[model samples]
Target: MNPPIDDRKEYSNNFLSTNSPIYERFSQHTPRCHRGFDLRVWLNNEKNLTRTTCFCPPSFYGDMCQYQNQRISLTIQFRVLSDSWSTLFAIIVSLIDHSKQRIIHSYEQFTYL
Candidate 1:
C-alpha cells in the first residue's frame, strides 16, 4: 500500500524508492524495470502492440536497458586539517581501459571549495 498523499517530504527521489511515488502514474499491468524501470504505453488500441522506454541507471543504457556501458562509477571523500576545511579541491575522475594504450572512455572534473 502507498503512503497517504497528504504527507509531504523534504526530498524525494521516487525512482530510487521501494515505495515509489511515481507508481501512481503507471497502470496495474505496467512492468518493472528489472534493475531498470520500463515506461510502457499501448500503441493504438492493440493489447499486443506496446512501446517501452527504459529509464536506466548511470551504468546502463539501451532500448530495454539490456546493454551495459562498460564503465563503473566511483565516489570519493576526503578530509583536510581543520584550518584547511575551506580549501578548494581540483579533482579529475576518469574511466580508463586496461589495454596497453589505456584508453579513456570518459572523464569528469570537479573544482569546489
Candidate 2:
C-alpha cells in the first residue's frame, strides 16, 4: 500500500524563504555606474582551459587584470567609453591565442549615446 502524503506540509517545506539583508549584503546590490565596467573571459583549447572575470574601476581601459591563458584561445567581452560627448560605449569579443600573444578571431561593436 502507498503511504498517505501531507500535501499542505510538503508544499510549505518546498517553498523558498529568504530575507533582503542576506541578499543585499552578499550580492552586488548597486546598479553599475556609467564609468564602471565589467569583463568576462574564457579560454578553451586542446592544450589548456581557463575562465576569468575582471572588474574595471572608473576610467580604466582593457581587462583590469589582463587575464590570459598561454595554451588556449580566449573569448573576451567588455564595454568601454566612446569618442562622442554623450555617454556611449563599446562591446567586443575576440579569440586570443595567448601562446602567441595575439588575437585570432575577433568581433568589435560600437554604440553612441
On lDDT, the leading prediction is 1
Model 2, position 110: C-alpha lDDT score: 55
Question: What is the clash tally of candidate 2?
Answer: 0
Report lDDT per candidate: 0.73, 0.53
- The segments of candidate 2 whose C-alpha lies over 4 angstroms from its true place after superposition are 1-85
Per-residue lDDT over 1-113 for candidate 2, one digit per residue giving the tens place of the 0 to 100 score: 64457876777665644555665566755533233444434576775776555565534444443333334355655554566456545555556657765867656565645
lDDT of 1 by residue, 1-113 (tens): 76665543423543356555565555355455655887777887755788877799877777767778674557888878988888989999888888999999888998999
Please list the residue runs of candidate 1 whose C-alpha ends up more than 4 Å from where it truly belongs after superposition.
1-60, 64-66, 69-73
User: Residue 49 of model 2: what lDDT?
Assistant: 70
Clashing pairs for predicted structure model 1, backbone only: 33-36
Q: Give the C-alpha miss distance for residue 56 in model 1, angstroms.
A: 7.3
Show the colliding residue pairs in model 2. none
